[model samples]
Target: MVFVQYTVLGIFFLMELCALAAFSYWGFHLNRGWFIKILLGIGAPLLVAIFWGTFIAPKASIPVSIPVRIILQLIIFALAIAALYFSSKSMLAVVFLVVVVVEMIIMYSMGW
Candidate 1:
């Protein structure tokens, strides 16, 4: 049970990484100038990372209730799914959504 718990946590961390990658992928694929592309590709994930570290990380600087944290997490993951879908990766988006849903369910059930 402990192993499963830690594994789920690890998967959650990977999901966060995937979200950043999704943002970068979307930004780079935008039909815009190189400057804009570079700015967004790097900046989007940076902003997300800052936000996560500030409010959503395990040892967040500004902690909230579990419900609020979960809501924020869902919002971020939703944005990542949208990014993947808009970037012509609908299948990947769906798969990501499924994994996110399962992870959230397990986390909530396990009180993680």
Candidate 2:
């Protein structure tokens, strides 16, 4: 059981990475010029990373109430999923959402 709990935590981390990748992929494939693509490809993930580090990470510099934290996290995750979908990777977006929902359920139900 302990192993499974830790594995779920690991999945959360991987999902975070996937979100960033999805955002970058969307930005890179935007139907714009190369300069805009480069800016967005780097900027989108960088902005998300900043937000995560500031308010969502385990040791975030600014802590919020649990409900607020969950809301913020969900918004960020949702935006990433949207990016994937808009990039025409609908299958990946659906799979990512399923994994996120499963991970959230396990983490919450198991009191992680």
Candidate 3:
């Protein structure tokens, strides 16, 4: 039973990480262009969340519903992805990565 809990959170952890990576490393921020910002800010993480949770996270028994969990996950993950998309340099990317890590930590530890 304990293993199941850890496994579920672990799956969420990695999915969160990928969202972080997509935003932080691939297609993060978008201050320069409005349309692109909307594209990455909303699209990338939504698609990734659906794909990752559907295909991979199930191995750990995470929820398949997009509406599950706190609203913050959607906001944070999507924003992180957007930030990653628009980031002009590695520093910004790293900041977004740190944000995701911190958010995950708080969610896991105390729902802090």
**Number of the top candidate by TM-score?**
1
In angstroms, the error of model 1 at 101 is 0.3
Best by lDDT: 1
- lDDT of each residue in 1-112, candidate 2, tens digit only: 8899889889999989999998899999999999999999999999999999999888999988777877887898899999999999999999999988888888778876
Q: Which residue runs of candidate 2 sit more than 4 Å off their true CA positions?
A: none
The regions of model 1 sitting more than 4 angstroms off are none
Candidate 2 local Cα displacement, residue 53, angstroms: 0.6
Please give the distance, in angstroms, between residue 55's alpha carbon in candidate 1 and its true position after superposition: 0.5
Q: Write the per-residue lDDT of candidate 1 for residues 1-112, one digit (tens) a residue.
A: 9999999999999999999999999999999999999999999999999999999998999998999999999999999999999999999999999999999999899888
lDDT per residue for candidate 3 within 1-112, as digits (tens), equals 5675676567667757766466534443554476776677666667766655554453524554433445446565656655554565556557655766665665456432
Kindly report the root-mean-square deviation of model 2 from the true structure over all alpha carbons.
0.9
Question: How does model 1 score by TM-score?
Answer: 0.98
Question: Where does candidate 2 have its weakest 10-residue lDDT segment?
Answer: 103-112
Give TM per candidate: 0.98, 0.96, 0.38
